[model samples]
Target chain A: MVEVATILLMGVFAALAIHSNVLRLAIIYLAVFSLLAAFLYLLYAAPELAIAEAVIGSGLVTLLYLAALKRNRVYTIGVVNEQQRDHLSDSYISHVERSKALREIRQFFLLREFEVQIVFVSSALDEALNDPAYDLIVAEDGEGFAAFTDDESYAMLELEMMVQMHGSGSAIRFVRHSEEGVV
Target chain B: MSDTNVGSESTILRLIVGLLYPFMLLFGFYVILNGHYTPGGGFQGGSVLASLFVARYVVYPVEDTDTEVLHAIQRVFLSLILIAPTVLLFTGLVARFPHYRGLYLTTMDVLIGVQVGFGLGVAVLRFAFFQGVGKTWRL
Candidate 1:
């Protein structure tokens, strides 16, 4: 019976991991795998692990998937209802500084033909830079700087605030463009 | 009949759900209550019930779901779940000092079972419904 269950479990796990597009499904599968593992442990006379899996695997995983779903949904819905969407840059960064870097990043997105978005998480303003469907998350309480970056760009930014937020020794990915950003 | 339509799977699915969901809930309750006497307990049963909720979600849309009431019940039970063990511990100590018919074991078992079940259920649904891991959404 255990062998059969394990085989079936493996099959499901494989199916779930193969689906990468929908992150929610992947997470659900992981939770399920953990849960099944717990049950197996219980059968094998290990109640401690069973309890842990029941609590952490199923409980916590479910909570995470739901929150992400709601956040994205709410933002998308807002964009649909509001026809015109404006950029919500940080007040400190809102005013176009006419910096060589910022201009270049903007131009690169246009040139490469990759639809891009840059959001500065701030409490004062909430606007979507390019896609109104997604917002510039102005977080009152959050850890680290939740922003995208390139390898070269990350090296340039001091990332002091982010370091303080996320603790030292963490890395950020900065995207780079080979071609010059042009309108 | 001109415009009315129901999928072939609809009737069968409803029948299956109707027959199984209530039984599942009842069985889960039995597990929690008889936890001391059996291998299974509240946490196991509560999870089963939560899975039933997932089934319900599959059968119906979230707007159509009893999400509000479900969450309300979860909140109430979660508080009870947290309080159960503390209550058991204190009450057990009191009984132990008297050295009389101490019922701490029984009470603690039952209370813990219920608490654990409710906790597990809430946790599972919290994650399954997309609230994000460890990030709680208040009912």
Candidate 2:
């Protein structure tokens, strides 16, 4: 009965791994599948194979898949404004959609062969900055605009230069989000 | 999905991995040493050892600069593994010291374990460094 349940769970995870749309979710499902496989190996009394599968399949393979997925084509940017603090206003959305700086930034990334996805995040700027999904975060405030990006980002210099050269009159400060204390 | 905090976010995870690190190393060596009497041998033990590197990488996403040294060490171990058996068997050393057969097997297991461990660790380190953290996407 235990073996049957393990097999069924393995099958489910395998199917889920294949069917999942998100790469990370698929990798996680695959890891879980491998873990089940390791359990099956243990049930079959193949401790060596179980150990190998548990370590390599679930651990090393998952890390490798995640590493490969890191080079994804999509470059996500979260756009936030003070108005989004309470709710996502339709006017704010339209305004962000029609922003020239956003268009320029999109075009910049598009020229570099990246699939630019501008997400109008309703979260606070600080919250959006904390989320690592956004490669870049553009926050609008009373002053002007603040773009937050990873300090270790290779494109930081280029991005800064581009922003400075092409930005309209308002004060746009590019903030490097250091990963020192966050870890 | 966000790649930054895959394994780094949870304090429990960090603490658990920290606690498991030494035990994992000890277990890998134990498996290798006891391969003659146990189910697990060099490859399994080596993989277990390699997972230590993976765990460290997951928690602290940093590019390992010591992979070249690991590569060199792996090559040396590989050569030793390939040469040791031939030298031992053809030179009639194994036949002469038949009582040392257990010692020989354990030594081979240790050599193979180290080789496999270094090889897989280097592979993981290279992958983790080269393709890590969306660093490849240099816009």
Candidate 3:
């Protein structure tokens, strides 16, 4: 009975929140929904996913959304296409906005067996985390994302991964962008 | 095209980047071809190719050549290159099945090639324009 009520309640809020432009309302809905998912994960004994979703989905992603809202006025979101497994083209996001959702792509990439190499050339920090193989990277930035960052640029992803292996607060060795080959 | 620091590159390193560039591009395509089985894919190879083009213009200036039409073509093709992959990816979602994902990725590789080629080609021309002075700067 409680499960049915949750399904109905969530389904209604989700459907109604589909096209609303109110930022507060959208954020609230996402928060509540993510919490609900955490509850389900706990019920199913999948604590890791529950925690990840709560921290990442409910916490970090929301922070990013807030940041984006601060940057831009409008927020546009797309729905998830459940059946999209083997399409040639990529752009089928629906559940959330693009960049925000893209931020979570690292999580999905982590769950997969294939390695991911993302290059972000901006003033911001490198955000790739949770993946396995990260190779031949170039970043002149400091520690901000991936929970850890190397101080230099142009090093194998292998080195960074090995360094980030200790914990979230670990720091990879720095390799200056202007400097010559391996030290 | 805007002023860049490409002028300072050592001729030898430039020579190596130039000599190895075409084969590197071809290798990108090779990665795309075997992407499903291998580690590389369309977007990776595409990005590498884009860098190659950027390097080419940094090495060679094409401002003296007719590049406006070529630049326009590059912009259109780059947008298209990004678009087509998305279409195919979504189509797979809608159909609830995997069709020709490999072929789709391959085609995406081709589009990226066109984009990287023309984008760098046009960028070189534009950057070269910055060097124009006196009579060369005539509108």
Candidate 4:
């Protein structure tokens, strides 16, 4: 009965690992799968193999996957409100939170296999714009969105096209920020 | 990226890992030493020791800069592991001192355990360092 349950759980986690959309969650699922495999090894009276699996399979391998994911660079997008003095107001924060353009931008980056990190900046637009840490700076412009990005970045070209295809037509205007001002 | 330190910020996690660290080392050593009669042998114990390094990295995600030193130690122990068995068998030492066979097994197990531990530890540390620099690290 114990072996049957372990086997079933192992299959479940394996399926979860494959089906998980987020890479980090997939890694965790894989680790849990290995943990179940180790338990099954122990039930089969293979203590030696069980110990090895628990350590290398679950522990070391999970860490290796995490390290690899960490090496994969994240696409950081900073959202700054235009004409904001002092801290970001609650209204602007909620508006950006509910913005459809922001969601589309996140989806665009996610489809390209880049981890999307949205940073909310309370500082002035010009101050946040100079920070080279941000891959793209998104600011609300009337009814549309203004996206400031490095002119050399090819990903921005693809994103611009994606926006157009979605018929978000001119809703997201790409502004090529000069490299000279960044450093 | 805002938080520069990749090490865990949770105080409870740090404290728990800190408490468990020494016992883990002790257990690894115990397994390696008693491997001749126990279910765990060199490989298992060695990986346990390697996990200690992994746990340390988890609690404090600092780049272990001594990967070269670990590599050196692993190579030296590996050479010793290879040499010890050859020396025992070819020299007819094992044949002469049949009673010392247990001693020979323990010695080999310890040697193998040290080699495997250092090797795997270096692999994990190098992976972590690669993650930090986000560049190809030579050596």
lDDT per model vs. reference:
0.49, 0.82, 0.49, 0.82
Pairs clashing in candidate 4? Answer: none
DockQ for the candidate 3 complex? 0.01
What value of lDDT does candidate 3 attain over all alpha carbons? 0.49
Residue A139 of model 4, lDDT score: 82
Lowest-scoring 10 consecutive residues by lDDT in candidate 4 chain B? Answer: B130-139
> In CAPRI terms, where does candidate 4 land?
acceptable
Query: Which TM-score value belongs to model 4?
Result: 0.66
DockQ of 2: 0.35
- Over A1-183, each residue of candidate 4 has an lDDT whose tens digit, in order, gives 999999999999999999875779999999999999999999999988998999999999999999778766577788876666456678977777677788888777655556787888777677888877777889876656788767577788778877888884445777776745532
Docking class of 2: acceptable
Q: Write the per-residue lDDT of candidate 1 for residues B1-139, one digit (tens) a residue.
A: 1122334338777778778878877876676566667656556655655566555544542433444555566577667656865665556755656653234444544555555545554554554454332233221
DockQ for each model: 0.06, 0.35, 0.01, 0.28
- Separate clash counts for every candidate: 27, 0, 21, 0
DockQ of 4: 0.28
Give per-residue lDDT, candidate 4, residue A124. 69
Q: How many backbone clashes does candidate 3 have?
A: 21
What is the Cα-based lDDT of residue B34 in candidate 3?
A: 63
Give candidate 3 misplaced runs (Cα > 4 Å). Answer: A1-183, B1-18, B62-65, B78-99, B120-125, B131-139
Instruction: Please rank every candidate by TM-score, starting with the best.
Output: 4, 2, 1, 3
> Stretches of candidate 1 above 4 Å error?
A1-32, A47-183, B1-13, B62-88, B91-106, B109-139
